[model samples]
Target: MKREMKEQLRQVFDTPDTRRKEEFLQNFNYPKATYREFLFRQIGYIRKRVWGLSLVLILSAFAVCKIMKDNDATYSMVWVISSLFPLLALLASTEIARSSSFRMSELEMTTRFNLGEVLLMRMGILGLTNAFVFGIVLFSVAFKINYGCLQLGLYLSVPYLISCLGSLILMNKISSREVVYCCAGVSCFVSVFNGILANSKPMIYSDKFVFFWIVLFILLCIAIVNQGSKLIKKTEALQWN
Candidate 1:
């Protein structure tokens, strides 16, 4: 029985197509193509909106500050808050892309691909593309704010990237609307928390926060990947029916 089990295991591992299928499943679980398409679509969708929103917010804050002497601090606070436009843009893009792809996949149900696989591909593409865009934004912000590029990128990129991954995990389980609202709420909370900590204690070691954040990020990533893989297998089985 031991020898028979070993032989069976060897056959499973040695089969080329089996290996290929395994790889395909792995890629499908993460869905790079879908993610890329989502990212590009999102960038285009937000291009106009970000600029307009930023301008409006900045101008409104400036005007308010000039108009009210006692409210100057509040106006300045509002202006600082408005700097989260980029994060908002990302969240909006995620909603639009996921919903559009879900609808499109439903229309093409006759195709060889399964809905779960399609969704994974879309989300993987989105995650990668958004990561790239976020990196660029980080660099730009660092330069504009006169912060050290390496340090600022380390602090901001880590959380933002993790958040994007979390968004993907959330996307798989929730409707597009819920995903948008959830991302917005979480992003706001993180931003506010970070801002408060940064302003209140300049000398605080952020290492502990970074460590916990990374641990949670890894766990969430694993959960999403596992759930996505299971969904694809279930969808594949259902296709036979």
Candidate 2:
């Protein structure tokens, strides 16, 4: 009797729609495969674009190194920090919006893994790429420039978080592709503004405000991650409405 009940349940789920729904629930995975393929694809995309990022960093580093070698002034470090990071932030923002840049949104949305998981995974990939670049710049600065770790860190962190967090928030008001341009523009503006401020007033952030920026960074990260899930759901739900 139990065997007969099992057979009936199997037959009920034998239809094409049920199978597709099950596959979707399994996150675009075959019974034998995992999401590693998806991850690798994202890695390759970053690798393909590595040249642009490298050029920006290399040129800035060369200029900074040449200028510093000529003079012992510590103020040169301010210009280096200000110039490189905001452009990196702009590039990172473009990476975050790659899906929209390619017009692959509808296809990505309906995949077996669905839009939410794909978005979260892609953003994770971009984050790692940015981290790699960040580390390189920090290492170079440590050897070549005379700046406090906290000061350089705040320069990178503040612009990066501002661009990413601002992009996520703008999704409500603009198309994702448009948000990329908006983020890039804002980052450019910030880069110039920061450059001016850094030169005029080196080390704008004091030791007392260090804890405040740290807390703000943590909150922004949490908000960005949480919004990924919400954005995906909202995107899909809009189709039905």
Candidate 3:
């Protein structure tokens, strides 16, 4: 019985098809094999277009602010909104790039490639892109405000990061176009709510409110991570080419 079992094990191990599949999997597991160069290329193509539009919006907002200043109502609400726009734009662009890449991968599913690596690369690229854009906007805003650089940076960075967290969460679930529309809607709603709240007398400026906001932001980050993980899992399960 022992000899018979040993022969069966050897047969299984020496099977040509099994050996070929193992070799194929070894090659497929290579980092370069799963890197998704097309996604990076797409991101590069979109970079110039995104920056051009952003520049136009910034210039227009500056011009409008200059006009408003002459009339003594000069704080550019437009610029403030623009600061938040990067978070939305980055998320939308990344989603588009990722979706295209995933579609291509689905087509390439027969190749010995892992989807998880592609997802990680996408997320890394998105994070880096947003960080660069966020830094530029923070510098511009600080210069415009003529405030102490440190103080202005703090205010701008925190909210921008918060928005980035929100963007990541939203992108995980929506298409690029849907992200754009949802951001627009959320911005409008937040603006209205803030306007109303600002005009009202504050009954609470307590530590509890500060703590509450912190907790909420933390929850948002957690949600973003969870959603991103789900997206990665779903894409993997779909076994996209």
Candidate 4:
């Protein structure tokens, strides 16, 4: 009698009509996440390793400044900061290129945010973080050296922009899986290029050539913007297909 009663209860509760269930759910209102909430939530999704490496670079910058403060190796500080900037920029690019790196572009397109929004948000967050770190480190070195903030900043930013431009170009042109290795190669190349500049053409850091650096910086900024626009369009084009 108990088993029969249990069977009757289950039969009455079990609904085979998914259409009815769907209609029931449609009648109930669900609270949606706000745009600001969604934006902030992406912060948690960013890998912890990026944050760890950023902190290490910041501390290393301080250490370099302290060690070279009393020595005649003040010029070497430029080499150190320039080399570090490429790695920092690469961190931002790697996060930006993550969808392609992991071949998740198709899945991202089906989401509410879409691939472009996701990439832009992550890039904005990481780019700002990198900019802040770069400013603090550059200002710290400025006090120990005789160069103006503008000049010291250029010395640091040029290498970073170069890495970003290179990475963006590679992401636009190369296959997904190979982009990671190419980006790494670009970062290493920019870092070594800084060393070459330091050793072979130390005078390039002089204020006399600051105008040329400014020109190169502007050109790189333009190139990066163009490359970035291309990359965004390429990803967005896939949605229609």
Backbone N/Cα/C clashes per model: 9, 0, 6, 0
Q: Is candidate 1 or candidate 4 better by lDDT?
A: 4
Q: How much lDDT does each candidate structure score?
A: 0.50, 0.67, 0.52, 0.86
- All candidates in order of TM-score, best leading: 4, 2, 3, 1
Q: Cα deviation of 1 in candidate 3 (Å)?
A: 24
lDDT of 1: 0.50
Identify the candidate with maximal TM-score.
Answer: 4
TM-scores for all candidates: the values are 0.47, 0.72, 0.55, 0.85
Model 4, span 106-207: residue lDDT tens: 887876676787777887899889988988898889888898999888888999999999999999998577788899999999999888878998889887
Tens-digit lDDT track of model 2 for 1-241: 9999999999987766445776686686444426897777656766455547656775676667667767975466646565667677666666656667668777766554666676667668767767787777666666665547765666556766766666666654566467777877777777777677767876565566667768877887798776665666656653421
Whichever of 1 and 2 has more lDDT, that candidate is 2
For model 1, the run of ten residues with the poorest summed lDDT:
74-83
Model 1 CA deviation exceeding 4 Å by range: 1-93, 96-105, 141-150, 175-177, 204-241
Model 4, runs deviating above 4 Å: 1-31
| lDDT winner, 2 or 4 | 4
Kindly indicate the candidate among 1 and 2 with the higher TM-score: 2
Tens digits of per-residue lDDT for model 3, 63-136: 65456556654234323544455444444444434454344555444544545555555566656765565566
